[model samples]
Target: MPYQQHTAKKMARPTGNVRWMVVGLCFLGMVINYIDRANLGVALPGMAHDLSLTPFEQGLALSAFFYAYAAFQFFGGGLADKFGPRAMYTFSSLWWGALTAATAFASSMLSLFGVRFLLGAGEAGAYPSCATAVGRWFPKHERALATAIYDNGSRVGGALSLPLVILIVETMGWRESFIITGILGLLFAVLWIKFYRDPRLHPTLNAEELTYIEQGGARPIDPATEEKISWLSLFKFRAVWGLMLGSFSLNFIAYFFITWMPSYLINELHFSLVKVGFVGMLPPLTAVFGGLFGGWLGDHLVRRGVSLSVARKIVICIGMLAGSSIALAVFVPSGAWAMALLCLSYSGIAFCASNSGSLCLDIAPTGRHVAAIMGIQNGSANLAGIIMPVVVGLLVGNENNFSHALMLIGVFGFIGAFSFIVIVGKIAPLTRAKRVKVADAGANNEITH
Candidate 1:
């Protein structure tokens, strides 16, 4: 389809960085989104004490969110595709924000579990919606950087939550922390609804900017002529399955930080809550740079004439291998050494994550399918979120030793490296075979349709 002609006044040259503005919104949304999710982990100790819950039960609370979250990813992608990112994002943020505040009211395990499950459902749409927006707004060359900018929220939010949530919990109480974060999300939802729009439909976009985006391969709004692929058809590709497995492995290691790291630091290393507030932030803070670097490295490799396949796979493998260092933390003698190893592991996971997200856009068959494919990969990957917390709880039963759990996460990082290297194929859009139809004529003859 041809680029949508701008009837409004044209600029001599592209003047506004509107695309970057969209990326900035996505980044802010991610930051708010993660703060809400990670707040639970940071506040878990106090919550558990208040509720009289055991470690296994605490794991269950964490896992509950991922159950609905995992289930909704594909569906959320479809919604983003059908409804557009602006609406989907607004709805998701509002839904999760309300639920995050409601979490403060939980009186029992069942109530907390129910609230978290619903919170998961509300938050599930965020990443897929952002993926859809990025695929549509940015060119192929800029996607990794754009994705990294937004994806970095996961680390930044996680990093911020350590001290921020701890401070809130320490001063205002855990219940109030939820209320505060939820309000931030609600405010962001308002901002997103007011400011976001499709680039073609954006009033502030200049002709030159639009042309530059189109010429550089930004996917325009879906045209009548574009062929639509069914969501289920995505499963037939081997790369899809490979991405699923690879992401699952990555998340297995990554979720440990989100769900269990605080406990490990406090219970095993004997760090005070105040100490954890300052010290615990280091690993994820390191990851902020790692993700940015990974995005730059992939884009740099492509600019230098490396094959997309070689470039993406190289970064992914290197990240997972570096992440495997988490196991080494168990052998380190001091808390400082252990923190360094964990930082290496978390940073490696963040490095791999930037490109892993880009792979969704890389392999999507069309612009329409970008979010659907993202949902599929993310849906599968988040199963680790559901399983890891419970597994760690069981492994750390009574002893509070995280050695076994650390080794397990390390092993999965190696497995993630293997999946990327061996299971995933060439980094390119998938093609589906066209279907032929037949028409029956009075049960006597059949003709191609």
Candidate 2:
């Protein structure tokens, strides 16, 4: 069926308590998800020193989570579709938390790798489920902003992880730091189970509000319909492949900085731990503002009559180009200038991620089927997490340096930018043929239009 035209009636936005309630919960979930992951990188220097790990071995450990995470993306989405976001969210949160705490018990590389891998498997559902919730709860115009608001968790997690990890590692031990971070996740899991309700199932949701969300293009698909959409069928489409490759390329750049920046500051630039902890937050701090700004700009462009395709692709391309180019600053003589460039580069990706993920929803044939699509995209992207750490390990091993690693990432960024422009094509629903053969039950009959 064709989309019904909106008759010039603009619905009023939800006022007061309800709006705040939803945003607050989502924001907390985002924070919990990122903070747990960020702690590992922050604590890595100490963990490495204590364990006597080589750069190659350290990279292997860092990439361990992604090994399982990338594999579980599809499974996570299936679980979300089968059990609903509430159950998936609650279970994943608790499961990852438990795995994170288990890291404290590790005395060897194998133990740490095992725990991290489990953590990844448990947390695989995080972003896709969050995207599903946004699809269920927000209007189309508001999703970018809502996504940006929640995505600040990455910044917050990265920012907070530095100081918190430093403090905990200093006061207690690196092991305690892992345990503390893990326990925080457990608390969030309990809260999620208690608070989240599917919008249709919530008696408090008003008709006017439902109509507003629905009119703005939110599709309240039956929970059952989520399962009816086959994950393998979604994978067969060219667009799905585009999202997968694009997301993986983007993560190749992103996870590098996320997983390695603090160590880079210490080893390459000769920064003190105190300085690393304090100054490291500046990039993510800038990223928070960049994401918010990018979200607002992308949505504004759409409202001004630009197609969603053009708006998303332009923002993402500009951000990737800027990010990749700024990486060249590593060659400059001044360390301060290099750090500033690094900051600007990640800020660009921050902006891009804020808007780009929402494109999955915009182009998904039905909002109901978005989880599986997002799952594949996320899974493919996370494969980069596995590949990046291992590659960085190879490039920056004991005798080698970062020059080749930096160049490789720059090339990837360039390729990723081209992909959005050339390969992504228009942001519209995919067409499938409507024609089907008509058969007579008893005898052969001519079909007429």
Candidate 3:
């Protein structure tokens, strides 16, 4: 069957309630992704104690995942662009799931580090694939909403992890906790493979929905299409550098929260392990709302005739300005109030973050090359994921005060805001070779509508 005809037929009669199912399933994938991410953190104390690891050694082990994860984001993005997200996501889930499960068996630091590094490599494709899926399955207006929906998984997963990990670690040990979470991810992978398809590829989607998506500027990419933008050539474009530097700075803040926040809560805030789990989960919980709130606001602004550039910038600017304030909360006299302020800060960060992937697409503006741009941006951003852990380890390993670390995060947060606000301009594409598809015929339609 011709591709259009196949989609047309499916559009005439989509499968039974698949749209909602697709959303639910993708949500699960994200949930599993985060559970896998946070599991190590939950198990960190046990792992450190069991292996007799020094703080530096533990930091190295913890950072092994980011080193490989960051490096492979480019490869993952390229592969996703080449093969489509369905297969890429499915394979990533399975590979990373198995690796995570295998982490339970590590008797030595070397083995633990090896598994974490491999886990990072395996999971590298997750976000690029999510972006690819959003590009394929959603309309332009709904793009941020869809991103918010999946992005919220990080928070939900983290939230769920605290209780789940505490229970499992208390009863069965950290190994069993890893094994159980790994199995859940594996199960979700099987379900995803069975259920998901591109909108044009799905049997359940109707023509109305497909048309609506196309009307909102979804374009299909031919998987067989092959192209590459060299690092040198990509660097020549100022927009690429802007995104790269912006992502890097944002991630500096992010990695501090992700890798060190729990330690801060336990060591500085004097929270017990179980309490630390719950408290550590708070920022992420607020982040879930922040992502949704930001996405909704950004879309609403777009609907109200604000340009995508302006809308994105406004959301990011507010988020950075407000979110960075949490860093200074470390100095607050009251701990409870301090946590509340930090929560507010992370909410802004989450809201600001929901725009980065979408902004990449805006800059690309034509071809379905988001995964490629994301690869470059994420690769640079993830360097923070790797380096921040090591730096935090050095700063807090000897010094009792983590205030310096918090100060650093605040500085980077402010810097991240500045990059997005100042360096990135007008949401314009860098490549003249890539024509703006929707803009040519109806350049101001969105603005005027």
List lDDT for all candidates, in order. 0.85, 0.75, 0.75
Question: What's the count of clashing pairs in each model shown?
Answer: 0, 0, 3
Arrange candidates by lDDT, descending.
Answer: 1, 2, 3
Q: In candidate 2, which residue ranges exceed 4 Å CA deviation?
A: 1-9, 16-20, 223-229, 434-449
- Candidate 3's C-alpha runs over 4 A off are 1-21, 222-232, 433-449
User: What TM-score, over all chains together, does every model reach?
Assistant: 0.93, 0.91, 0.89
Query: How does residue 104 of candidate 2 score in lDDT?
Result: 88
lDDT of 3 by residue, 1-449 (tens): 10121111123322434444566567678888888887887788787889887777877887899899899997787788788888988999998899989999999989998999999998888888877777666555556667777777777887777778877998999899999999987897888788788888888778767665655555467535424444345544556667777888877876666667777777788889888767777888988899889988877787667777888899888887777776777689876877887788778877987776577656653345677777778888888888888887887775546877777777877788777877765675445343233335443211112
Q: Choose the strongest candidate by lDDT.
A: 1
TM-score of model 2 relative to the true fold? 0.91
Residue-level lDDT tens digits of model 2 in 240-302: 666777778778887876788888888888889999889988888888888888888887786
User: Where does candidate 1 stray beyond 4 Å?
Assistant: 2-15, 433-449
Candidate 3: TM-score? 0.89
